[model samples]
Structures are given as structure tokens and as C-alpha cells.
Target: MVAILGCCDSTNPVRRDGGLPGSVPAPSPGALRAEDQLPRQRRSLTSEDRSAIAVGVTCGCSYAQIGAMIGRDKSVVCREVTRNRGPDGSYWAPVAHRAAHERRRRPKPVKLAANPGLCRRIEVAMDEGWSPGLIAAMLRHEHPGTSAAARMGRVSHETIYQALYVQTRGNLRADLHRQLSLKRSARKSRGSTGRGGSHTYDHALTISQRPAQVADRAVPGHWEGDLILGRGNRSAIGTLVERSTRFVILLHLPGRRHDAPSVAQAMITEMSKLPAHLRRSITWDRGSELADYVDIQLNLQAPVYFCDPHSPWQRGSNENTNRLLRFWFEKGTDLSTHTPDDLARIAATLNARPRPTLDLKTPTQALHELLANPPAA
Candidate 1:
């Protein structure tokens, strides 16, 4: 067959391109000259090399022959074939590439772990329930003078966070994740709210009715509030965060259905406990649960303002706090199981924790400072 095709029966034939069929094209003279000036190859495997490997293995070709065709060392070819192939010896190109990529990507040790003093600093902040962003901000606030060594020791919050969540290579202890507000086995982004739009209630004061001071966040007592629904919408927990201090208040609804009347009574019971000054106003989404806003307003004396349809960001602080609540009250679980005392404890913990928006002060401290010296309202 080879003779009929006008080619010698050499076991491996290099085409005019200087490579076997499906191999990388031959380098031009210009390419050869440029190679000397370019950086060395990372020795990483390429897709073409993997294709050659699959073909060579199918033809029972030796490692040396495959390596020559792909311009890789024989040892590299052998390792690639042995490491990436399935138990039945199949060399899928996509599988090979994924295996090689996973192997080549070796994680580096965390910077905080290398410097004991810096590690201790990070550990202390975490112990005090400081978020990674807060810790980083505090570091930036502290870094001063022209000390090169001190500056080099500081690391970003992302580095500290990767040390906690990524697979292996974390110098931090597993228990360290406890200090994080959203502790999970793996990190996941906050995604859609999954709540469908329902213009169920009418006669509402829109967020536009809200004072300009709420947007500026200069005035204390104005709070953003929302209900975080639990499993199958059968349970819920109310969240309230003051605009200025980010102080949190959680409402534990022991009842099953969080309908308007039930939620209104819960809001009244929770808000009435607050000092009259701290109960300025409550901003919430237009979910049917808050339909009894008039009742809540009459009882707590804190008028309720509804966000525009499908506009959660109007109550940004409450939305963010609800995400944090997912750390304790995981989605698709019964939230009513938690007692009011449990809710209070969680709220207190959140309140005592430092906030970057609050100038790295705990919400408790910021609220205390604001109340101690009220702004000229």
C-alpha cells in the first residue's frame, strides 16, 4: 500500500512539513531564528501533542517515535500517556488536557503563613470576627513610615481568603472558617434571589417617598428590612440593618406561613423593643408578606416604605445582610426552628463584628458613637 502511494514503507514518515500527519507544522527559517530570542518553553503539553499521543498509541508507536513527532522529550510523552489515560488505556484529548492542566497548576503557600507576625495579625482580626475586607482595610490603615520589610509582609484579603477555601496547601487551620460570616465547605457566589415578581399589594409608599437622608446614610435610625424565605416559602426570618451603623436586627417568626398579618406583628414586636429614636423608618420589598405595612406603622410608629417592583437594591443593606444570614440559615431549610433568642444572638454577633463601611468599627460601636453624639438632625 505504501509503495502504491509513491512513499517508502518507512515505519514513520516525516512529510514535507517536517512533521507526521496531525502534528505541528514545521517551523520556518524565521521561526528558528526567533526561537533563540524568545523565552524557553514552559514544557507544558499542548493539544497537538495530545492528539499525536492518541494517534501514536492507537498505532502501537513507541514513546520515542511519538516524542519525535511532537517535539517533546520521550519521558514527557510516557508520563502524559500514563498519567492522563483511563484505566482501559484510552487517551481522550480533552481529558488529557484537563489532567495536564490540573497537574501543572500547583498552588503556592499563603503569604500570611510565611510571616509569623503578619499571620498573627490576620489571626487576631479573624478572631474578632473581622471580614477579610475589614482586615485588609485595617492593615492599609496601619501601614505607615518607609519600612520596606513591614510593607512586604502585608497581604491582600483575597490571599487570606484563598488560604481558607482552596483545596489543600492552606496553612490556616480548618477551624479558622468559623470566624467567617459565610462559612461553607466550598465558596459560592451570591446569585439570583429566585423570588418571582408579584404585585400583590397596593396602597404602598414607594421608596421615592423616603427622605434624601436615607440615600446619604448620614442619618441614623433609618433601616432597610426584608424577609429571607426558608424551605418552600413555608418559613422565613426578617432582617433589619440600620443604614448608618449597619446594625442588624433579626425577626424570628415561629409560625409556618409568613403572610402579611403574621410578618407585621413580628415586625411590631421586634421594632417596638428598639428605643423610639432607633425606629425611624423601615424600608422593605413589596412582597405580599409586608402587605400589612399600615398595621406595622401604626404599632411601631415606624413608617414603612416599599421598594419599586423587582428592585432589591433600593434596600441594599438589607439585601447584603440577608446574604450573610444564609451562612447561619442555609437556603431550603426551616428557618422557624430557630428561637428569637437564637436570632438575637446571631444579630448580636453580627453587630459586634467589624464592618469596613463603618470605618472598621463594630456596628455596636458605631451605633453607640452616633447615639452618644447625635448628628444635628
Candidate 2:
């Protein structure tokens, strides 16, 4: 029977109404399975994938044909066509494609974007010589009545540093780079020597020998001090910052060569103004400016501890304070031009600014509180 069936078609094929050809028997309606009637399986389309397909169609593929190719519903293709259509009634394929590509390529949005107006205000504050940390606290305090979403709340100084140093995505203004404190060259890696050199003052104490209470900041009077050298090595300013309060005191050095005697006399004179209990150990780097460390210790009745050579972190409070100081006295500028009154004004500004780390209190506030309640004898 099978041989007859095969031979019959080869010899005299029967013609169908549509064309002259041998026709295969169609499946009966009841015999056709549900699975057989279903469309072929296709890979699922993600939001991104759908966007791409939409762009591709807008560029010029027929809706039914694209649906067949991508295994999507024909209606999905039609909706995509309608959604991305321009105001001119034209479906711009290239524009849609570019938009999709850029959307997929974007990085996570910045926290600053939450309140752009606030960021601009913070930038203005920076231009006025306020530190990022200070600006962040001011935003929270001054704008308490504003909506939290609208306010530029607390952001760390480090966060501001990252935005300034790390290039922003889609940022068109390269000139904005100037707003950063450190130039790109300053960000490069540099090797540092350990605090190995010995100071000329024989009686000076090592930082390791400082009292446990001082190291832990349990008591309020311990301080870190250093010198900010200016151009020509002829001019310099002595800086002192209380560890607990971060209160800064700028010393007026008469001349570079007079630094030893001048720093010693300045420490004695300024520290004497504070109550006896407020004068504790002072930490300093091994710079020659402090060659008269013994005299400073003797006059103030406070031990002077020398940090390791080239170890700025040991006197981190002073180092951080110096960075803030740069806004007034920039690097490479002659410090001789600044008088004692000018330096004092800068120090006053720093002390008055609120510090986030100090619970949004100004250094002056912390210092006043310390003064009101002296430490136990």
C-alpha cells in the first residue's frame, strides 16, 4: 500500500485549487494538539532589550515581521513605534537608538543630584572659604524648615573631595576642576620617610611616651602644632590646633631664621593665656622650626612630643587645619605679606565654623564648654 501511494504521486499528481501540485492531507480540527497550534518559543525580552528592539523598528522594520523575528507580540512592536515617535509624526530611529544606548551606559546618579540647588549653594560657600564639612552642617541647620528632600543635608568633607577629584559623568565644564583644593599633580603617589631623624632638643619626648589620657583625647587640652612654610623659605606661620576642640592658633613668626626663638616665645605667650589645666602636652613634627622645643616645654609647663620625621599623620589635626589654612594663604604665595592681625582673623574664622565631627558645634563652643568645667585634678 505504501509503495502504491508513493508511485501514484510520481506518475499522475492531483492538483489542489490553489496551485497545480500534489497536496498532503491537512490535520483534522480535533486532531490538532494545543501545543502544535501555539507560536514558536522565543527568548524573553528585557526592558533594555525591548528598548533596543523598539529603536530598531523605528529605524525601519515592519511591526509583524519584527515581532516574528524577535518572537514578541505584534502589539508590543506597535506600542514601541508609538511611544518613541517624535512631535513631527516621524519615528526617528537613530535618535531612539542613541538614547537607548546612552541610558544603558549611564552610571548611578550622584547623591548631590538629589538637590542641585543645594550643591550650588555649597559650592558658593566653598568659594567664600568655607570648608565642605562646614557647608554640609550649615545646610542642615539653616534649612531645617525646608523639606528634607529640598535641603542639602549633611555630606562628609571626604564626599565633597571625591566629587572634586573624580570626574563627574557627562560633566561638560572642565573649568570646574579649579574648585578643588589640590591640583591633579598633588594627587600623585609619593614615597615618605619614616619619622626617623632626631630633634636637636635633647629633652623632647617621643609621641609614644605621651600620657594615655592625652592619646585617647579623654582630657581636652592636648594639641598638635606645625609650621606652614611660605615661598623663599623666608616666611612661615606657626599653627596650633587643640585635639579635642580643633581650635586653631596662628603664630606670627618674625622671620625664618628667628623661627626657633620666635616659635618658643609664641608658644609660651599664647599657651599662658589659657588656664593652667588647658595647657597639656603639645605634639610637633621634627621641623627645625621647633629647634627650641626644650624652651617651649619649660615655659608652658607642658611636655613637647616630637612626631617621627615626615610623619604628618602624627600631627593630623595640624595637617588638616593647614589644608583649610591654604584658602587664605595659598601655596607658593609669600606669607610675609600677612601680618599678625591677618593670621588671627583666619584662625578666628576656622574656630567659628561648625565641625560635623564635633556634633555640629563650633570649635569655640567646645572650647568654652571645656573652660566652664575644668578637668579633675
Candidate 3:
């Protein structure tokens, strides 16, 4: 039987009479040169190397360093340690060394190299309705040692997502795919509404025509607004935010009936609360609620700029504000349960949370600072 180099032989070959002997072939000159050109492998670990690896492992060195010392890949080292050492806890050198030696003799392919257990745990958590981000954070917190350091035992939330979407990984557990909020598929972008499309009201200004200062968000008076719908589209809350300060304001829409009159009234009432200096312009999408936008502009004395239809990014501040609002006013709930006062309290809470974008300052502090020393005319 002739055995091919670097190739698998699955069938047993029967002896044939008068056949050439299946002798191993000598290396060709090219192969010899290739082998000679390769870098020399270190035969034994130096004291310094061992010390460094020991220190690293003790001080939470990643599996990568351990593998480098042993002349193996990081995932191989991780699997050896995870499979041999305390599967329940942290890695110890003696146990890890023994595991590595045993694994070298009989290697096993990993289904999910980065934390098979952790991945399973994450799947369980997702089944229980936890988000991927939340699961990642919890793993880092709960299993600090193994979950935080490893090529085979630790993975980011993004990795979890990629594994689910990318087909090459071989779906080990298809059930895990169900945990994703959005199914894996190309998303259809919304069509752009023209700059001159129908407006919430006659003679309304388009976002493109808004002042340069508003676009730059250097001025504190520029505001963006939107609505979040509740279950059955019968309940909703109006959300507005100051672009510069991220200051949030929420309005309780008693019923989901966001008609022109009701929406315009809400805008007027909210804008009326701010001083004239803080009411420069308002940006909104082409929702029917803003049909009476002319009334809002006239009553509030602030220009109303309409975003192109289906373009949520046009009112970025309001879009971001709505995301934060979701933390409190979740989707598919009866938003009408909250009163104007309740909505005000929710807005106040959000304004008090520190924002990294705002130099870790709470929106309240940022807004107060802006109001304290108003930008020069």
C-alpha cells in the first residue's frame, strides 16, 4: 500500500503481484531547500522564557503568550488548558502542562474553540432573553479569569454574531441563531424623500436649508424631535433632544392619535417652556403628526425644518434620544400609561446620566453650562 505524504488514506490496499515496491521517496532539492530555509525551532524553554510565561499566566497572561512559549498556536494551548485544568475554574501551570502533553499525543478538533461552555452559557442566557452585549459583560464579570483571557475560551459579542451569520463555521447549534433580534439578511434601505417633498405644513423649511450653525451643532438652540410608538400603534410618546447638549424632553401623548393638531400643540407647549434663545429651530421627519408644522412654527416662533421622508439620520439627535428612551419606555408597551409628569421624570433621569460623548458630563450639567454662558450673538 502506497501512503501519500500529507494526504489521508482511508481505504485498505490489497497486495498485488508484480507491483513496484511502495517505498518512501527522498525529498527533492526544492523541498530540501524549503525545509532548510525555514526558521530553526527552539528545542527547549529557557529559564527566562519559563519565568515570563509563569508570570504572565499568574498575572492573567492570555493563552497567546503560553502558546508562544511552547511553540504552539494559542487556540491549541487554550484547549489543552481548558480541557485538562479546572474546567470549573482558573488555569494552573502543572495541570496545564500535563494537559498539553496529553493533548499533543491525541488532538481533538474543537466545535467552538472560544469557550464552548461560555458559548453554551451565552446561548442559554439569550434563550432567557438577554442581549448579546449583556451576555458578554456578564461573562467577563462572572467568570473573570477564563472568560477574560483565552483564544479558545473567550469571545466578544461581535464574534457571537459573526458565528451565527457566517455559514462556514458549521452551525453547531442552530438554536443559538434564533436569539438574534434581527435575522441575518441584507437590509433594504428606506427610499430618500426629496428635499422638496410634501411637508408637515405649507412653506415649511427643509433640513437642507437649516442654518450652518444648526448643522454644525455648535449652537444650543437647535433641536431634533421624533415619536416612539407603543403596542397596536394606539399609544406613543413624543421625544425631543437638544443636539448640542443632548438634553432630552419627553411628551405624553394620551392616545396614539398623533394628528397634526395634537403634535403641533405638543411641540408648541414644549417649545414654549424654553426661553426664546433656546428655541432656534426644530427638525422632524415627515410623520403625519407634523402636518400642522406651520402652526407649530407660528405658535412657537421657532422655524420647523423637515427631514427627508424615511430619513431618520436627518434628525440624529432625536434618533439617539429615542434609543435612550427605549431603556425606560420599552417597545410594545402601553405608552399612554405614563402622564406628562411621568414622562418629565423619565427625561430628567436620562439627562442626569453621564454621557461619554459629553466628556462624561451629565446632559443636565452640559445643558446648564450652555445656558449659564449662552453663545454670543
Candidate 4:
């Protein structure tokens, strides 16, 4: 034998048999070799990577050992496990991977995160119970000129809202959401006769009295209205739909009642948000729930019109939207269970949705355009 032991198999200097040694065993025949497939550039773990981790964990592999197997730094594996565990704190592969996907999707830096002043303004307004839309308008109103407005951090309500719902962006504190009137983890649609309520109106301006311009939908301010009732008509929500822009507003009411006074107050607080030009008129059904119509007309300075008795069609836009709202406030559920902040979130969702009437523009976009170039009152 001519000194047969020359660097453990001579030709191959880095063989597992003698060199640095194998970190991981060769993949079992046909096993998914996804460990090396994770995107190195983005620093995000892929679903396939998660599946491999599950296999490694099942096989009693330690984190450092697993990191070696996957060609990743041990610290990276450590962070992934700590950050993306499930609600139960168990590192189930599927749940951890799904959460990673949600966290990795932060497409833009949140407006509140970018501007400290804007963040402060939002926090103050939220504490005062102002909706995100109201905060946005206030920012614009205070900084009127276009260039000055941009410089002053005049962001849209949609942007403020984006921070709240998307997991990847946490510019707004999670506790601040509790300060919002309705506090739902997710939004719900609202409307009901079967889904929400109905009341009869007396001595009210009839929809027939509404102006021709209002009927044509050419102008931006005209709105249609209705209510979604809760179980046995005990609880309710006030819903308003803009005829031209197809925008929606939801009113949070007294938990047990959508009474005339309560409904009127809710509408007053919500509608007071619009500029004078955008407060032209509101057409609703003759449901007695709006017995405070005269008060709404006088105080809002926006006239109110009633639909003919038993005819939901007179408030067609409102009627259609109410049905769509049924997806959230189902007929037999307790409407009172939802908070005002919940209604605000739901309205945001409704406004952000694309509408066929507005050439596929979202109600939020159509409203934005209208706000930019409103028609003469």
C-alpha cells in the first residue's frame, strides 16, 4: 500500500467523508428540496422553507443545525421562529408561513410613519372621536393650497385607514383602534329589512319634491338613505348612499334604538363632515325613524325628501346599498353589538370598493374627484 491515507480520499478536498464534514444528510429520495429555494435578496422565508422547517423540527433538529442544513445564518432562523409563531405559540409551519406572508407585504411606508406631525394630528383627532375621513379633511382645510397642502402632510382618509388594517404597517398604535367608534378586527357590510329595519314618515318632504338635478345624478351632493334593523327591530344602523358618487356613510346609533331623535343625531354628526356644497340633499323612505327630518333639514342646511309610502324604490341607491350591507349586519343578529368605530371601518370598506355606476372608480376615488372639482350649489 502506497500511503493510501492521503487527505481522506485524495482528489476531493471537501468531501463530507473527511473535509469540513456534511452539515445535513442528503435529501431522502423525492423529498422536496426547498430549503435553498428561499429568496436570498428579500430576506423573507418562503412557504416551502416553512415546510422544510417543519420536517426538520419533526426530526429533532436544533435551530443551529437546521440553519446549517438550510444554508442560512443561525440568527436568521432564530428570528423567523420567534417572530412568526401562531396564536397558540406553537410553530406550526402553515400558520407561521401565512403570518410571514402578511407581515412581508408592507408595500409602502405608512403616512403616519413618514410624517410625525401628521401622526400627532391623527392621534389627537382619534382621541376626540373623529373619523379618519374627518381628520383628512381637517388637514386639507387647514392647509388649503395644493402645494402647501402636500407639504403640510394632507393625506387621504384611505391612507390613514391603510395603516390600521394592514398588518405589515403599524404606524398607528393597535390600542388607538379601540378609540375609534367601531372596533372590529374586520369590517362588515350593513343594511336590513330582513337585514336591517323600516319606519313610516309623516309630514316630510317627499322624494318627488327633490330637484331634477338631484334625480339626474350629474351633481355630486345628492344622497339616498335608509336604515338596517337588528333583531326584532330593536337595534339599527343609519345608512346613507350618495346618488352620484355612490359613496356610503354609516351612522352609529343608540344600541337599543334607531329612534327618530337618535337616528337624526347620528346623521347630523356624520353628515356635518361634508362641505356645504356636498350637503345638498338627502332622500329617504317615509319610515317614521326619520321623524326628526325637519331638524335634519334645518340644522344640516341640507334639505330632506321622503319616498312614497311602502316604496323603497324612491330611495333606489340607498335601497340597493342596504342590501349589499346585509353581508355584514345579518337580519337576526344584534345590530347594537357593533361599535361606532366598527361602522366607520365598514363605511371605509364600502367607500373603497369599486362601483359600476362610477365607471369602476371606487366610491372613495369618485368622492375625491368630486371634492377636487365640485359642482356649483
Candidate 5:
């Protein structure tokens, strides 16, 4: 018998019995092979590959060995095993494969749907007039763990928003969107085009002269104040947000008495209830309602600072709080209808809502901590 070596006809070089000496034997012409069915360039793992991986894992083969058996990179094998493993830390081929399919399916179940506990928490927060971002942050803040449900609870802010705005994404309550600060059925472009009327506060201290500490919000007492006007600008509510804690205090400027004296007195009465340390500085826009800022400074003993004309962003915390207050006190409504007690309740509700800026702590909690510790001047 002649031995064939490296000839085109005997490229695979088999023994007399027809088995390749040092390599896998060629499949029979009519026989199907596992590798033959796999696409030449597969984007994802196939059932056959998963089956091979399962067998390899059961036999204690290394990831590289398993990948070699399945014609995939070692990292690919590693990721597949790591991600699709069962809860008990076992990698079952069938379960993993099913999970992979579920993941690949378009419009997979909404996280908030499968997780009712998470949905309830989200709904409660939304109902409390919390922003989606705030609710998301608070969820993450409270559930800082690696458990399955904890992981589910850590949905992104955009996810909570989609649950509210996108009809099909989550199991959140239908009316929960109305509980949002904006109370809008759909999102709108976020911007403000209304310009503040130019006013000269010749004797007022501009935000430029404000201390560096106030701008950075390092010390706990600095505040930002503004008036959210009602119908025809006849009635208004004064809003004060602590720059550090975002703690809100709503002034009941009832009977359309949002004049300079009324606003100043309302602010003084509400803010004076705090310890002097918690009443450090006040920053305001150039609104005429705050014309008697001097009286506020004298009574509260906190110097009032003014933002530059037409620059609402300068008092960002206050601007944001005003927008939130609008949820309870809508524009074009009679502000006087909400009495002092009503205003107090609304303010309490707002201060109780968690703020994203305050590390998911409610402004009330942050303020309490500040009061308890009382940061130095």
C-alpha cells in the first residue's frame, strides 16, 4: 500500500481505517455537522454553541477550551456564561439560551411592569410631585445593593420618564403622569423665552458682589427667592429655596398683595422662624416685588443679593422651585384662594420631596441635618 503525503487528493492524510491521524475526521458527504449549520459570521451565539458550552462547563473545561469547541473567542464564551447564568450561579444551557432570546426580543417586558414593587415606589414618588429624575435618584439612593430587585429598582431617570411619557413602556399608573411637576401628557421643549424687564437696582448688591461661599452652596444658609405670578400678574406666591439644601418656603402673598412690602414681610415672617445660621444670605431677581429687599435684610439679618437683569439662571435653585410650585398653584389662577395654611401645606410637600441635587435627600431632611449640625459661618 502506498502512503499519500500532502497530495491534493489526500490533503487531510487519513490512516488506513479512514480516520485523520492528528485532526478531526472529515464528515461524511451525506452527514450534517454542527459547525456547518452555523453562519460563517455570526453576530450572536447559537443553540449549538450554547449546548457545547454547557457540556464544556459541566466537564470543567476552561473558557478558552469551551470557546474553541464552539468556534468563538474566549471572551465571548466568558460573557455568555457570566450574563446568562442562573440565580444559583449555575450556567444551564437551555435557561441561558432562553434568557438570551428574551433579551434579543424587541420591546422586551418593561422593567417597571415585571417589578410591581418598583412601580409602586415610582408611582408614590410621582404622586408626591417628584420629578422623574428625583424619583429615579431616590430609588437608587435607597436601594444601593446588588440584589436582583435592587438592581431592578435602579432604573435610569429616563426609564421612569418613559414609563410616564411613553404609553407602552411601563406599568406605572395611568394618571401618574398628571402627578408630575409639569402635569403634561407629553414632554415639551424645555426653555424660557420670556425676558425679565430691565430694572436698575442702583443701591442693591448684585450677585457679582455675593460671597464665593454663597455661589458654591458650601455653607448651608444661602437662599434664592422669586415670585410665581398668578392670573394677569395680579396675584402671586413667593418661593424661597435654600441654595444648599433646596429647602422650600412658600410665601402666601394673598389678595394680590405681592407688592414690595407684602413680599418682604412674608419672606421675613417665614424665614425668621429659622435659626440665624440657617438664614445666611438671600439672592433675588430684579422683580419689583422684591423692591423692599432692604426690609428683608434688616429683619432676617441676612443680606439680600440681586441677580443681574434678565438672568434667571443666576438664581437657579429658586427658578427651579418656582416651576415646581406651579404644579400646585397654576398660572392664571387666583393665588389668594390658597390661604396661609394651604401655602404651608404646599411648602411642606415641596420641602418633603426629594431633590436630585441634595443626593436624593428631601430638602427637609437636608435642612434638619444642617440645623442639627449648624455649619460654621
Candidate 6:
């Protein structure tokens, strides 16, 4: 392969009548040089290097071997070959060289710009409270064919996200951000820190005692519970999220009485309606509202576990649900103003939204599937 390296330099001033003895002929004038299109600082393949790649591909050399021959990395060879290969998988040096230069052109138009129909479809889904990822997945699902439209119709979740967040790529509707769950006008970085402590009560089980199946989400019915506090921590709504299905059930904790008995009674009343298999266990935060956990266990017939002090990630599902619930039940407001019926409606709405983790299935759909053919005892 080293013998093929003679033609790998584009700066060789010594010109041959035809070309290097055994090397592929220099790409025609139409095949632009790297310096012609890109800045000098950016490293791009030279015309000779592309010719070597063409020969290497024709000789059935691996990308790593080709890279060695051209003084580049295996990934560079792989990306060049994969990106510039012909429709029939052949690598013609001249064609590949031209394609590379074309790809280097800047300020290209966004995908949604030429596809109004795709923009409309994306907007409609967002308006229906669907995430960008779910909309992208559904697009791929609906356009599974290999035709140009089908191929062009499918955009990545990242593309949809960029269209929403990046002003340069803004082709979707201007107000579509309002349709997002968080409804932020711009992107934000997220991070978290965990706190450590043990359970305070001698009889209470900590998250460590919960069965391994609950952590793995191998079985349905394990639940994570929490409360979304309202203005001045006076009122709150109880939240329950099933681990496996991500199904949600909201408890109406009317008034400012979010104490132990009030919370436990509301939780028992809502969770008791489900089947025994669907009431396996409940993991909750260390708030005093769940002090009557024993009463909850007695009525629901499920063990109650407490998270370590200030460690909310142990109840991840419930925490996520509370965040979503905040969209409708905003902070600094009277949560008690919404009746039990309002809570039911909000829970149903949240459950109906599709989850990316659920393979785009709504929580309601996943729950119904479980009910249709539940696991045997």
C-alpha cells in the first residue's frame, strides 16, 4: 500500500505527462482542490488522496489500510467512502472529489424550508403536545418507503430540536416553542447533584430494600410517588408514576392540609382502585406528609419505601411527572382551586402523551397493553 503513496501529495510540482506511473490519473480540472473551497487551516482530502482512496476501494482494501496508505485516520477514510460512494457503491475519484467540494458549501438551506408539508406535520404534532423526538419517530414510521420523498421526509430528532432552538435554522413556526412541554423560548443546560442519608424511621424501608425488579423495571406496578407543592408550600397535588409503563395518577389534595393523614388517605383512595398486581410497591420522598405510610401500606397492601434525605432521583418517575404537571398546575398559584375532576383530566392528558422511552407509545396505551395480557402469578 505504501507504493500507492507517491500520488498522495497534491503539491508535487513535478508534473507527469499522463500521471504517476501506477497511480490513478489526477482528477480533472472540474474536481476542485481543498484550498479552492475551504480555508488553509481546515484539513481536507487532496485530489491525489481521493484518487488513492478510489484505487484502494477498487482493490478491496479496508478503511484502516487505506488510511495508512493516505496518511489519514481510518475514520476519515470510512466517512469519505461512505459519504461519497456512488449509488451502486462504487468509488469514482472524480465524482467523490466533486461531492466533497459541494458538501463544503456553507449557509445551506434548512430541510424544512423546502418541505412545507413536513413543517405543517411537525407543527401539528407539536400543537398536540408531542415532543420533537416523538414527531421525528412518527415521521420515519409513516414514511418507511425508500423513495426520495420517504427518505427526504424523515428528519432526525436533533434536526427538529435545532429548528426550534437555533434561530439560523428556524423554519418551523415561530410560536411552536409554546407547544413544547417546558415551553421555553430557548435551550437550557440541565444538571443535578445527589444528597446522601438513611431512613429516619426504624420500621420504614429505604429505597435500598426495594426489590431489584423495581430498579430494572422488569415488572409492572412498582410506583414512585411525590407531591408538587403550590404557592408558599401551602397546597399540593399528589403524584404517582408506575415504573414500567410510566403511567400517571394524580391525587387531589385540596386545601392547605397536605399533612400525613391527608396525603396517605388520598394516595390509598386512588391507588386502591388498581389490581393487586398493579399495586406492587410505592417509593416516596422523606416528606412528613407520608408519615402515615403504615396506613397506606395496610389499605393498598403494598410496601412503602422512603428515599434518602434530599435525594429526589430515587423517585425519578414521580419527579419527572411533577415537572410535566407544572405546565398545567403552575407554581405560585392555588393548586386547590382545581377540583378532583380537574386533577383527573390533567392526569389523563399527561398519560395520553407519548413517551420516547416507551417506543412512542402513550402511557395509557402501554398500561392498556399490560392489562390486556398481564403477567401471570
Alpha-carbon lDDT, every model: 0.75, 0.67, 0.66, 0.73, 0.77, 0.80
Best by lDDT: 6
- lDDT tens per residue, model 6, 52-163: 7877666555786666555577799899998887778899889988988888889876888778888888988888889888988898998897667797888988888889
Screening candidate 1 with a backbone cut-off below 3 angstroms (N, C-alpha, C), the clashing residue pairs are none
Evaluated at residue 43, the lDDT of candidate 3 is 47
Candidate 4 has a TM-score of: 0.47
lDDT of 4: 0.73
Question: Which regions of candidate 6 are displaced past 4 Å?
Answer: 1-46, 71-75, 128-130, 145-148, 192-212, 215-221, 226-238, 244-332, 336-377
Residue-by-residue lDDT tens digits, candidate 5, 248-362 = 8888886788888898888888898999988889998887778788888888999999887677889988887888787788877888788889988999998888877778889
Q: Candidate 2: which stretches are off by over 4 Å?
A: 1-180, 184-203, 256-258, 375-377
lDDT tens digits, residue span 275-370, model 1: 777888889887778877888888988788888777888888988888877878897798889998899899998898898987789999987876
Which runs of model 1 end up more than 4 angstroms from their true locations?
1-200, 374-377
Find the candidate with the highest TM-score and give its number.
Answer: 6
Estimate the TM-score of every prediction.
0.49, 0.51, 0.53, 0.47, 0.49, 0.55
Sort by lDDT, best first: 6, 5, 1, 4, 2, 3
Candidate rank order under TM-score: 6, 3, 2, 5, 1, 4
* Higher-ranked by lDDT: 2 or 5: 5
Decoy 3 TM-score against native = 0.53
Of 3 and 6, the candidate ahead on TM-score is 6
Cα-based lDDT at residue 369, candidate 4: 80
List the lowest-lDDT window of 10 residues for candidate 4.
Answer: 1-10
lDDT of 4 by residue, 105-131 (tens): 856456567677677778888998898
Clashing pairs in 5: none
